[model samples]
Target: MSRRARWLAGACASTVAVGLLVTGGALATPPQEDSDRSARTEVAVGAYLHYGSPGVERMRELSRWLGGTELRAGHTYLPGDTWSNIEGAPDSLRSWARWRKAKADRLFVLNVPMLEHNEAGVPDGRVAELIGSGAEGEYDHHFRRLAERLVALGVPDTVIVLGWEMNGFNYTHRCRPDPENWQRYWRRIVAAMRSVEGQRFRFDFAPNRGGDAIAWTRCYPGDDVVDIIGMDSYDQPPGSTFREQVTQPYGLQHQVDFAKAHHKLISYPEWGLFRNGDNPDYMRRMLVWIAEHKPLYHSITDYCPHGVWQCTKNPRSARVFRELLSAK
Candidate 1:
């Protein structure tokens, strides 16, 4: 099954107005302090280091190659094994965070599961039912537990990318079929997580780069509930040029404009070569664009077939990456 299909079959289950609202807490800023920079558009670079080799050694290696701490943000996923309440920080996650913290400050982009599974066999109606009834309190319980666990693990202020890519049709959390309930459920999760004492988590309202499924704006939960606006953009669609990718409706530029208008920080939690692999220009263009726009953080997914570290699929892109990062 395809990635989206797997997410759909495992279990079917599962953001914002613009500005005028402040983030939930004052502590919801980037972990590092760059005094010369402004909050609205400060750029902190990082990547998904554990994609290929799952450990701190890989991260350290990447950082050494990049000529700085590998990254400020480390992205990972919470698999759809079970939708039960989290009792404490998972040992692996705790270990990873601890390892990541040793080298540099970490901003974890945790892609959590909204459903029990994302298998193709699951019916939309069943998934809709879960969303409609607030997932039978599972949503609140899960987030509350997650928040508590994070606080206990010493990783407070995590930018929770809750129900990310919901506007995209492929995921189980797609918002089109029942956007109203999706938005409400998001609000509930935010409230529940925030209710956890000492849990200073920021919520990132992220979507794919285009209207491939539904118009992302239609699913906006509201500015008050979201702390950042993120995008998971990849070099897909084969023939489209980089300029077109950013200028297209619901593309990177749209995401940036939306975030700027709302006074929220921007984050590219996931971005890398896809259909157009080894395109050095894409790497150069992306780096320049990121530097110009200055989002809070951006992460390049470094995994086999799509990574710049372990996988040698894109040598030119890797060269550009090293040059740019090393110069910084």
Candidate 2:
């Protein structure tokens, strides 16, 4: 894998006292090119609060700390150890649905891993076989169950980040094993999920930044099946400049252009400090980039190495993140 330090951080516990601190205070705003704020994209701002119910409380605490900057997006992942877990467990679904139902505008992002034992380091031959099975609809019922469960739980309009970072070789659902079969499986899963009644889910096709195992485009299911084009970008490719990150092949710029051409919105499902430790410049640049591009919803994976808030190692970057995002 060309990408590094993109691991999902363990459960986080934020000790930052609510409503008391604003590290750098408000950022100086530039003169508005147009005063019609209504027409502007007040993008849904959020962070990966946690993988469980404590995330809800963490969101509350984070909001207060940011002077009530609306943390409208809540992100989490289904445990991929088993097909049953992928079908949506009651303990987590109930809590997240409760949170989503509390506010009609809150965006719920759920990362759905397409394979069981998703991170077991399965070999390519076995992965290829599994992808072939999935492409032939062997696993359609699992996603259908998940969709029905989400609908029944009252979160019918959740954004489903299916097979996230598929362009990378990090998971069993990866697209590298057989790109053809991978896309077929993606479309099949989407079809199964959509067939469920009372479901309104937006599927996000997110890839890790940079050209990894394969060109992300080769794995694209299609424009019709995908609603949001996203990237799990972190400050990486050690010693690379932010400019290089944007202009590099299959990097941020390419993703934006690709989404625009497909007439779809974009998002950063996962982003934050990486490779470059405590680098505030990368943090500042990423914030500016998000504000400029205006994603549908972008969530910084808020845990050590990638997170600025919960993680203690990157206070400088944390200050930059807090100051920039808080002002918006």
The candidate scoring highest on TM-score is 2
lDDT of 1 by residue, 72-187 (tens): 66676666556652333346677656754565455766766565564333556776777877734556877788888888777777778888888865556667778888888888
TM-score of 2: 0.89
lDDT of 2 by residue, 218-327 (tens): 99999889999999898889227677788889998899999999999999999887777889877776776676576888899888878888899999988877775563
lDDT (0 to 1) per candidate: 0.68, 0.81
Write down the TM-score of every candidate: 0.82, 0.89
Number of clashes found in candidate 2: 0
lDDT of model 2 at residue 139?
A: 100
